[model samples]
Target: MAKTGEADADAFVEWFRAAAPYIHAFRGKTFVLAFGGDSLLRPDFVDLVYDINLLNALGVRLVLVHGVRPQVEERISEEAQYVRGRRVTDAATLEHVKDAVGSVRVDLESLLSVGLPNTPMAGAEIRVASGNYVTAQPAGVVDGVDLLFTGEVRKVAVAAIRDRLAAGEIVLLSPIGYSPTGEVFNLTLEEVATHAAMALEADKLVFILDHGDTVDAQGRRVSRLTASQAQRLLKELPEGDMKLYLPFAAQACKKGVGKAHLVSADVDGALLMELFTHAGVGTMVTRMSVENIRPAGIDDVGGILSVIEPLETEGVLVRRSRERLEQEIDNFFVDELDGRIVGCVALYSFAEVRAGEMACLAVDPTFRRGGRGDGLLAAVEEAAREQGLKHIFVLTTRTAHWFIERGFVLGGPDDLPAPRKAMYNWQRRSKVLVKDLEAA
Candidate 1:
């Protein structure tokens, strides 16, 4: 039994170590967590709170937006009608909305304030701050039906929220906004969450969905999508909780939120798994293609160095100084993943020979096996073709097989363009390989 316990401990240590990069990436980043009131009724809600406390401990600034839909229904004893996505909050329903939102606010504050021994909050001193952070305007009539007390977020007090967050407080936003004239109006949590993320320029907007996972038409689970892809997929998804959150996620992305995540509140530690793991437990939506292959900018020098330095040390790549990289920065193309340069290749065009030399091809060690290297090569080849080059060549000592497998053929030094031949390093004795760009 003791040996088994030791083995389990070792596995856990390894898993924790693997999550270190995510931890570093999220530290000091602001995340807006949104959920419906129904989620609070689940048996696992306490566990979700514990996970939230864990995030807070890790230095993540949090703004929690919760919808009181179920609670409002319970207060009114009927389902509220929504026309064109705006709830028709009549005068009678507005009273229920106030009661429901107030009750939820108190409950969430009480839960987050817990500090009992032997609990997740035992030593946690989490400060929950709630206020009139969201300014509102009446949603108005849609096709002749007045929304009455229903409202939409017109503005968010970003400065005040930032102040609270700077002081290590979690800002809690109930789906209740106040007009400039001091009238309270019922708000939709989705709209509030989306606008808040935009106003705050948050790193992420997370929706705790009832549905656990997202799948495509073929029933295959999808783990990531760009905003454009999400918009296109939304048209095909069935009417469910996931579908309901898709538009809001896309809107958040459009307004510059770094990413939006849809994770099930039903799953224990789902938020942790989605944020800290490489293959997230839920679907991630981003504003643009997270993996971008484009021309490297002058600012990419540091990232380029980080990707190739190890390869240089291993003698797999030739050493290039920072000054040299700066001079040739325009010739380099990089594969940027989530804003990090993970792979790069430089295309040195030989206009006289109608040929290009692919050099300094490198991918970060951690990301090498994931086809980022292939993406960089494809990008460089396309760029060469655009520049009217008919052939592209590479001189590699260690990655010859990689180039060869990608359709490059063996060639001698004499096959190189005259200018390139003069600069060939005989000491390295690297093998030359070339590919015809116009070939099928």
Candidate 2:
């Protein structure tokens, strides 16, 4: 590295240029990002605010759910009763959950008050409301244990949240809900998001949590899974033990909530990283096969869109403009069924080195099990080969197993070609899978 005199202003330009297309695709989509108390109240909270400001400026609709379990517990006396080995909620505990969740919302709004291009997020903007959207019922009994005032989601006012988001409001949903019969209950952030996703029919239902432990048959953590797979995995979890957060995610996905993301609370910029770049940070659970894969044609913009609209609602794939995809048309491929476009994949390439990246690989659900993904993959690989490239790679978080089965193996960040690296955004940490087609 030369003297720090030469800043990579040029690199930033190239960086945004490379990312804007995909990022713009998500501009108006509803994305629910659940931030944990740990991440929110971290010492370096200013950095997090900056991230939020950036998200706002980019025009992404934001809905935030914050956790305050520690604060709630600390205030609860050492004498508070425990029922069935869980915190027994008394009058004091419920109030504290309200306070903790309230303080978090106030503090977050306060943080935003201090920064950003347009602080419409505050008073001059529409007032932010927290309660009532989540009409809840008591999480009455757990494992024969009497739980007091622990609210479980009964219904979500999807229309209300949707109206606000459509009006360009950043929705802040603190983990506090109103119950029927005029009572309030403390709800888990996961429960809130699950019901919200299902209600909003959100494009993406994501959880930024302290722990996750979903794995495939192999040793690797399967980062992407379908709702069915997630449900199957959930059923395997012992009753009253919902550790992975996949069951609710699967519930949301099955309910047409779109894609569900479970990621580390500690992974700063995980949201941005997942949305903006190819390499993403966490496990994404969706309801479809060939996630983000699809079939397209020059004249079938409507057809391409017809396939994407349903998935878009569930948030499995971010939405993009027909014109934009057309501009990048040469990068796309199709799955032909007697000349009908039943499946498609898009290949984004680094032409300087003749290397290419595969994206948007999808086939009709009925056409699945007919070797569509494999066939399309072969076609793309052949195209890459025809371009005189020696290797082609896929960056995926969940489907690494599928790629591994097809001769691709895990690769580190440095293993990526330099040009591609220039386009990598640190937020996503999208995992890489590579296969070599060159001969010795």
Candidate 3:
């Protein structure tokens, strides 16, 4: 038996190995982190700063955009005016905004400057940069009311920011901008972050929400959303900061920002878990469709073979000749990500008995924890249903538990359609599991 410390060491080794791919992929990539001022007031803020330091050390170019809503609210004496969530920013409130932004910016700089011995920041030399990088224009009047000093982002100094990032500095931006006439304007965090991401073509625009990730109608956290799906979700979300910020995130995706993530600052290490782990801890929004399932073509044969060859070699799946797979390629479906086939499954129809066979389910080992397998299964099931099949079954030698957990019931060769039953491998003695499509 292994000792507890040894077991822990093994687990740590496995986790680090799993994270290696992400570390390699994210090196030198730009990520924009946008957060409200309240995030700095949290008890776990030190941990967040440490994670930022780690990312900087790993060569991830960081642009931090901070909001001063709570800070400004604390400094103001009277109720703030707003129209559709945009602050009115009267002359008196403008003074408070300046003070609040200055104070919060100094505190954040102080936190990032920490290099205490025996701490995560020890030996980490993180340089901070800030300036009038965001150009602004007044939001003017909306709903027949003047928004005054509240402004919208007009331009971002992409070249200057790139230079700062190249110089090994984390660029920080307060929710404030300067107009061409040297007039100062109060801005929103979402707009500044989105504009910066779009201008710089950042790899990711991350929003550190006060709450957890986005959820569906049942309140279950959704792991991913396409830009269209996110736009639809915007309609269903209640009036809050998420609703206000989601549009900006979606807009950034449409404008060519790589991906947008909404994560919780309340959860310790949420940022790291979301970035390094396979199944991220937050909801990701992207411009591309998340469901890339499509009917396999002749060109997909190699990719399909790559996914199943190992399983076939291990005896978990039956071997298929290249010629045989080519002939039946039209009956297969593949899950593709970034032009790589990560998973594949096949469906064979027996129209005479209204039954179908689901077979050759496989996913790449590194991509298994995600729902690629489930997606491939769903694609096969949908194709079977389209062919008017009333039942689907699988013959498995090792994945019996997987099928059982997915609602398949124990069955025998006699339960199969006549044509399939005649071909059952009696010598192999594979377990036969069946599911009723109508009952599903």
Clashes of 1: 0
Q: Over the stretch 1-440, how does candidate 2's per-residue lDDT look in tens digits? A: 55343457666786687578767777887777775676665775566666665676667777777777766766776666656544566677888887887787888877765644544333333334455788877767787877887767888887888888877777888776886688887777777877777777788887765543334434345555666667666655543222447677777877887678876555667666666654366667766543333335477666656655665565544457888877877787776555456777777777776667776666667677655676678668767887887778776655676776567779976767797788765666667888886630
lDDT of 1 by residue, 1-440 (tens): 99999999999997798689779978889999999998889888988888889899899999999989888888786677879867799889999989998899999999888788989768999999999999999988888999988988889999999999999999999898999898989888988999999999999999998754566666666677777778889888877668889889988987899889998776779899999975677888877542488899999999999998988999999999999999999999988888898889999999888999999999888876654676677678778989999999999998887886567989989999998999999999999999987772
In order of appearance, the predictions have TM-scores of: 0.70, 0.62, 0.73
Best model per TM-score: 3
Q: How well does candidate 2 match the true structure in TM-score terms?
A: 0.62
TM-score of 1: 0.70
> What is the number of residue pairs that collide in model 3?
0
Q: How accurate is candidate 2 locally (lDDT)?
A: 0.68
Report the Cα lDDT for residue 269, model 1.
Answer: 91
Q: What is the lDDT for 294 in model 2?
A: 37
Clashes of 2: 22
